[model samples]
Target: MGGLLGVLLVWRVASALFGGGEPGLPSGGGTPASPTPTDDGGNGVPASTVEVAEDFPLPAIGTRLEFKILGLGDDPKRCEAVGLLVGDDQRTAYHHLCGDAEAGTDVYFFLVRIVNHSDAAQPIALASFEMTADGGDTLPALDVETANATREHYFPERIELGPDSRIKKFVAFDGSPPFTPARLTYVDGTQALVIHLRGTWIGA
Candidate 1:
């Protein structure tokens, strides 16, 4: 009987530790996990835990942009440019918040939030993204070579966004002193999406 009791206690402990308890039951009555952190931390400043560029502009949250899916014969899907962050510190604590470290002074970080509003999934090719400045300079999306050199985080070659789903990804650009991008363009061979960045700039 003692042996059986000991086994039962062991089972209970294992279940608690391994999430084997009854469904919907709160373990230890603690709070649930929090959602991922966005750029806005409720205050007017950037939500980074590390030092950011002194003059970096913060894009207003909820700015919406639309895109058409080529070959799908569907209506345009909406993508919101949710966040914009730039800093020189490679060891910034915000690294985990967005997924990658900074590249340094020569490389700056740009984050854009893309949300799908269509009924079907939308595939985005990160490699096709381009940043254009008002000075007639066009910067291509970061490639493997650039990413390795900067040690900056980058998006996957392709990402599928389910209907009504959202994803925030980092896009690195080559610029010694960070400047506002005039426009962000994405070409997927069949269709193209152009987002004007004229009024989206907010100084730090």
Candidate 2:
């Protein structure tokens, strides 16, 4: 009985850490491919390498996207109000379930802006947004309820932008340890845009 109880406890802890006990997280799956330049498949979106200062272009849809990390101590009031405020029960539950409690991982937020520079309206499928850790784990953004709370713009599921129009929002991803590199990618069937992330500093 003692041995069986110990085994169950270990399983429970593992389930909490990586087995998708948290809402909006996918269940365990194979590790994702590490972010790297891929050959252009004739879709007009080239595989480009860029620093944080560069804007990744996706001309196939006549739009450009920019991503910026909300660095340490740069917390926004909306982010604080959205249940991610330090010591909030929701955030604590996330850290205990979806995060690496021992390694102090939680969630990190980023600001993303998409601009349509073409002569006509351009449509975007926001569901294609995803982030991959250097460790090869695919981190899904929190569900719309939690993620959209961080900004008035509110991340949308799909949208069409008029010429010279732009939309920006805050997206929250499962956090990693300090300096754990990651990449956020927006890949639809025809075009792909990549944003190289320098890693996050916030911990549980």
Candidate 3:
């Protein structure tokens, strides 16, 4: 379902990418309905409801990226990817994980957060993140591991990057979706979180 050049594009995982009309009414009380969150496409994944102007300028801090964790426990130590759908498929595709086949490394989508430490409006082109499996020594491509620990938006899912920026690509990955990270050594300024995640084993 993905065949783009890879520039600045938006993404999502664990939820449906396409959209259509709302589902029909419950057949006399089937499984209870989940809460319709306001900050999302009304699915489990989170997306931005704010809009950016065309002439918006970049703020002091380039762009702070963040993410939401669902299937994990509260404790950070027990909050890591161990045995879940961490690969690309129909239902549970790891859509956020983007890589350059030409470069020979993969990046994983763990989380995205915005730290507005600016006084004026922080106009960011987009927000993006990356990860590596080789101790930051080399870049690696993600193939849906059993222990992935990141979450992001995608598709009709509504997690927008930018109309043309890669950090938050307005569209999905198409080979040139703006973001071409090297290695995920300094994810948002933190050390190797994926490594810590492996040791913590969230929900283990």
Using lDDT as the measure, which candidate wins?
A: 2
Worst-scoring 10-residue span by lDDT in model 3: 51-60
Q: What is the C-alpha RMSD of each candidate to the true structure, in Å?
A: 20.4, 14.1, 16.7
| Number of backbone collisions per candidate | 0, 1, 44
lDDT of 3: 0.24
Taking all chains together, the TM-score of candidate 1 against the true structure is: 0.42
| Candidate 3 wrongly placed segments (more than 4 Å) | 1-109, 123-128, 138-204
lDDT of 2 by residue, 1-204 (tens): 232222222222122222222232123311222334565433223456321222111111212432222222222322221122322212211121221233344454444566665677767665666776667666555444432132343466677778787775645554444324356666644345555543222433
lDDT of each: 0.37, 0.40, 0.24
Deviation of model 1 at 93, angstroms:
19
TM-score head-to-head 1 vs 2, winner = 2
Residue 161's lDDT within candidate 1 is: 72
- List the lowest-lDDT window of 10 residues for candidate 1: 89-98
For model 1, residues 57-116, the per-residue Cα lDDT tens digits are 221112122331111101112111222222321111011111122333333334455556
Give each model a TM-score. Answer: 0.42, 0.47, 0.26
- Name the top TM-score candidate: 2
Q: How many clashes show up in model 3?
A: 44
